[model samples]
Each structure stands twice: as C-alpha cells, then as structure tokens.
Target: MTDIIDLRSSLANRVQRWLAGSLDQMSDEELLKLVEAQSPAETIAELLVATPTRRAADDDWTDLLLRGAEAKNQIARLAGGLLSSSQAAEVLRISVPGVKQRLERGKLLAVPLPGGQRGFPALQFQRDGHVRKGIAEVAKAGAHLDPWALLAILVDGGAEGGTLLERLDDEAVLRDVLSRLAGYGEHAAA
Candidate 1:
C-alpha cells in the first residue's frame, strides 16, 4: 500500500535491532526469508525506524519486502472467525435449515453451542467492534421469529431502501422484521 522498498536489508537491520544481543549468526538470506514469510513491510518499517543498525544485503531488498508485506496483508484480510450453524443463520436471518444449507454450500461455519444445547453463539456475528443486538424486541412482540433474518438483514448492510438493521432500536419494527424472517425453520436442523 506504500512505495516499494528493499525488505531483506530492512529485515536484516530490524533483526539486528529487535534481537540486537540475541541475533543468531545466520546468513542474510536466511534471515530475509524468515522475515519475508512473516511480515516484510513490518520488518522493513522496523529496519527503517531502527536506522542505528543498518546492514548491507545482496540485492533489491525493497521489492522483496513490498511483495512479502502485500502477501501478509491479503492473507490477514481473508481470515474470518467461525460461527455455529444456528448462530450463523440467526445472524444472517436465514432459517436454521437455510443456514445448514449454506454451511453445506461452504458459505458459513457451524461451531457447536455451549453445553451442546444446539443453539447459535452470539459471538459469531460480530464484525469489527459492532455486533447485532436487541433480539429481545422480537421476543417481546406477539410474534415469534428466528434471529437469522434480523442478522442477515443487518449483514446485508441494511437492505435497499430500508432494512431492519436501521430500525433495530424500534422494537415494533424489529419485531415485525423478525416475524417475517422466522417460521422458515420448520425443517431446520437441530
């Protein structure tokens, strides 16, 4: 995401600094490969910051570092947390059956519920720092609905013109949304 710079030299420099007294008497290439694997950019940044301990390397350390950093960033972004089948469905507002179908399709995870009670874990739906909440509103209403519908709506970025996510605080509206999303679980897996 930034200008390309030499990585191996940077890494070598960093290892020299971070592990100042403890750096193994290893080859520059060996150290570069290790740094390249973990976080080239971070390593390079470290080296740049720790200019007090610079070292010479074979060739273009900047290119190697940039490639390594790019790779690390992509891999980090692809990783996601796991969720129980029920929790996945509840958060997505799909039926338990629908959630299972998606799981079968490799669309979501199916972590086991606590005590093996066969319910979804709430933690599965959290993204970043925000999480879905206020399902009690639906419970309070006369209608009984599945939690997935609300979650799915929320995850979908709140639908076209409007969605339940925006009105989660409005007990009445949320209840209605939940009612509509519920009852699709007649054939859902337990």
Candidate 2:
C-alpha cells in the first residue's frame, strides 16, 4: 500500500510539472501555444521554473517579479509621488543643472523613448534605488534640490559616474527594461 501511494505521488508530481506551463526547451510556437492555453497563475508558476536553464528560469522569474512589483508601483504612482525635473533634481541630491545635464546627455530614463513613441508606460525611477526620493522624503529633506540626483549618482557609480548610463544604452538593457515594463502593462490590462 505504501509503495502504491509513493508511485501515485510521483506520478502526480510529474503531471503537475508537465501541466504547469510550456517548457522553454520547446520551439517558440509550441511554447506560445502552451502559454496561451494556461491561466495567468499557471503561466506565472511555470515561468517561475520548469525552464531548461535554471539561469534562464531565474532571469525569467526576475522579470515576472518585476512585473508584479511594477503593478504595486503603479498604484503607488497614482497616489501622487511623481516628481518633475527640478523636483527630481532635488530628490537626486544634485543641482538642477546636473539633472539637466543628465537629461541633455540622454542619461536619464525618459518616459517616451525617442522617435516620438506614443503612449508608452513611464519607466519606474523608483526601482533604480530612487525610492528615497518619494514624497515623504521630499517633505523631510526639503525640496530645494532634486532627490533623484542622489539615485542618479548612485546608479552612475565608479570614478567617472556614467557606467550605468552607458549600460542602459545597450540594446539588451532596453529590451529587458521594455520587457519588464510590458509585463506590468499586461497585468494592468487584465
């Protein structure tokens, strides 16, 4: 009886793993069909694991987590914490000119990508270690300087302070950023 129960348990686990979602090892079309057939929760679970590469699975999982985080973030944004250029400057702990310099140098993450992209989601500056620049901080820290400058300085890093900016310029960075952003969009629409 114990042997039979153990066999059943093993069988159930296999089925759950198989039914969880489409395997990444499959072709794109096959994977899409599997994903499309599954419910969102199932899809999320499958994406959490069951991929060929654990590394790839981790990468994908990070993406999904980011999406969920961004959703929570959207609610936060609606509650009114967005800062303007000068306001953001104060948040970053930098001069307004420095903020302007970063913007002019195309270092800042702009809401709308170049080429006049229409109605895209705003990039979450909060996630890039800019949470300290929130309204609460602005209230506490005094609003004279941009708080986001603090975040910018931190993200910029290194002796020169533009490495993060350069990394953001990479095509892969844009794709990953846009992908995570798009994931949030899907959840919002649902």
Candidate 3:
C-alpha cells in the first residue's frame, strides 16, 4: 500500500512538472475557468480556447505533454488491466513492430504509457488470442479523438446500452455505438 502511494505521488509530481509551464502562463481568469470545467477534456478545451495562438514551437511541447498526461491518467485508472506493447504483441502472436503498426493504423487503440511507452487495454483481445470483432472499426472511428477520450467511450456505456467494448461482438450494434460516440465528440467540439 505504501508502495502504491509512493508510485501515485511520483506520477503526480511528474505530471505537475510537465504541466507547470503551461499552467504558469495562464492568467487568473483562465485558471478559474479551468477549475470550473467538469472534466479534464473540458479543462483542456478551455485552456486551448484561452491560448489558441500558443501552438507555436515551445508551447507545442506543452500540448503534447498535456495529452500524454491525460493518457497516463486514463491507463492508471484501469488498475493494471492494460498491457505494455511487448505484452500485447506476445498475446497477439506478433512482433512489437506489428503491434505498433496496428496502433498507428488505428486498428488497435492504446493509451500513452508513462516513460513514453504505449499501453493496450487487455479487454480488447479475447482469451483465445484474437482481437475482439468490431474493435478495429471502433478504433478507426475514434482515431481522431484523444486516446483517453476514446477509452472513456469504450469503457462507459452510452444511452443506448452497454459499453462499446462490451458490444464488440455485434457488428451492427458496434457501428451504432461508434456513431453515437462520434456524435458526442462532435457536440463536445462545438
């Protein structure tokens, strides 16, 4: 338990360091707006809105760091259910490069791991050594969204019913689910 606590503290410290410069640049009003946002995505959207012009050189690093931190938080919340790329590759009976290529092609979804690695959710693969049916479609659908946001959609059920991940066996249902998630993303962006 103490080790877990220490790990959490260490992770938090690293995230704080990554975010420090961007947070430091925010005005009081922007900071207050971020505080008022309901979720991390909303907070990040608010921050981006406040500094649209900050996409220049140095600030680009801040944006990447923020995204990486969000991915790390999402994976951490999964409680070790995610596998490292090497583990995923072994499970899939493929090389690490193949696993990475699948991720790059949006055939598999992954969250950013701490230390600049990527973690694939174990739930996406069956115990029999096969990728869940329709998962590729869902991943392709969510390719434009942040990895954390995509994971949320997969894990949390929408108004229609079960989670996207849970419905992967039904291709038609998965399509509907993916459409609903895409709508949510559009609405959020607007």
Candidate 4:
C-alpha cells in the first residue's frame, strides 16, 4: 500500500480538478476516509451529487457500485488470468457458442466481467491452445464451489512448487486434487 497522506493528496488533486473549489479544506483524516472506501464509481457518484443529484442521507446508491467493483477485482485476482469469450474461442479453436456451452457444462471456468460478460480463466489453458487434460473433471467435481474459489485452488502453487495444473495429467495426481476439491466443498458446506 502507498503512504496515506500521499494517496489522499493525489486523490484530492484529481477530484479537485472536477470542481473549482479547493478540496484542501477537508482535514487530512476526513479526506482519507472519503477516498478510502470509494472506488472510481464512487468518485463518479460524488461528482454527480456535487452537481445536483443529492439524495437523502440514508439513500446511498454508491454502496452497491463499490461492492460490484470489489467483487470484480477479487475475481480477477483469484483467477490470476482471464480471456474474453471471443479470445477463448479463438485460442481453443472453437466457436463462441461452444465456449458458452463449455462454461455452462462446468468444463471451463469463467470470470464474470462487468456488463454481464464472462471471461474464461486463461491459466486453465495450455500453451498449445488447449485446456489442460483432466481440468474439466476437477471443475465438475468441484461444481459446488464458486468460480473464484475453484480458480484459487487450481492456481495455487502448493508446497510442490507448481500449480495443480502441472500434475493433473497423472491419474493419482488428478484424484488427489479432486480429493482436495472435495475437502473444500465439505468445508464450505460446513
């Protein structure tokens, strides 16, 4: 993370550009708190209300927007990589509808993008433009989990020093990863 004062000063400078008034009038702590909880969308909300879109004290519309941004960020981080449907189709040498069908059938993991678009996890695919063998089997076995959770487990380089993707080709290795996935499901259910 960055130094708080510098971050606050930088953001205040950006927001100050939107209005002629100086944002420095705000105390250091107040300025930090205002910008800290907010994302870019929250800044947009602030700008909108700065003009004429004020609402009641309790009617904060920015909350959901902030949550949406956070969720998107988390998804991208957990998946480690993503590709648009078209990109995935091109990489897999399949049609767009085929990509969608694979996603629906749990043969592929998708990162949910904003505006209802979904992207495939790029790490799940090999350099040969094919999905790693046995990945779909583990994904299907872990269908009880969310995409982010499954991706996290798949991408984690365990004590073995490589991702589960590397060893998933072996029968025992695939079964071991599947057992770990089952453990995750049991834990999640509990």
TM-score of each: 0.23, 0.23, 0.58, 0.58
Give stretches of model 2 more than 4 Å off. Answer: 1-81, 111-123, 126-175, 178-190
Off by over 4 Å in 3: 1-80, 158-162, 188-190
Quick one: ranking by TM-score, best first? 4, 3, 2, 1
Per-residue lDDT of 35-151 in model 1, one digit per residue for the tens? 775576776554454343545342356446656565533332222323455556666767778866644453332323235433333333445423345543433331233333333
Looking at model 1, residue 133 earns an lDDT score of 55
The whole-model C-alpha lDDT of candidate 3 against the native structure comes to 0.74
Q: Candidate 3, clashing residue pairs?
A: none
The better candidate by TM-score, 1 or 4, is 4
In candidate 4, where is summed lDDT lowest over 10 consecutive residues? 53-62
Task: Report the Cα RMSD per candidate.
Answer: 15.6, 19.0, 12.9, 10.6
Candidate 2 TM-score over all chains jointly: 0.23
**Residue 80 deviation, candidate 4, in Å?**
5.6
Error of 1 at 19 (Å): 37
lDDT of 4 by residue, 1-190 (tens): 1123434654465445534332434456645555774587775555454454323332233345445455555555545557889999999999999999998887887755546788677767888988888878987988877766776677666576667766678787788889888788566568
Best by TM-score: 4
Give the per-residue Cα lDDT of candidate 4 at 189.
Answer: 61
Which 10 consecutive positions of candidate 3 have the poorest summed lDDT?
A: 71-80
Off by over 4 Å in 4: 1-80, 188-190
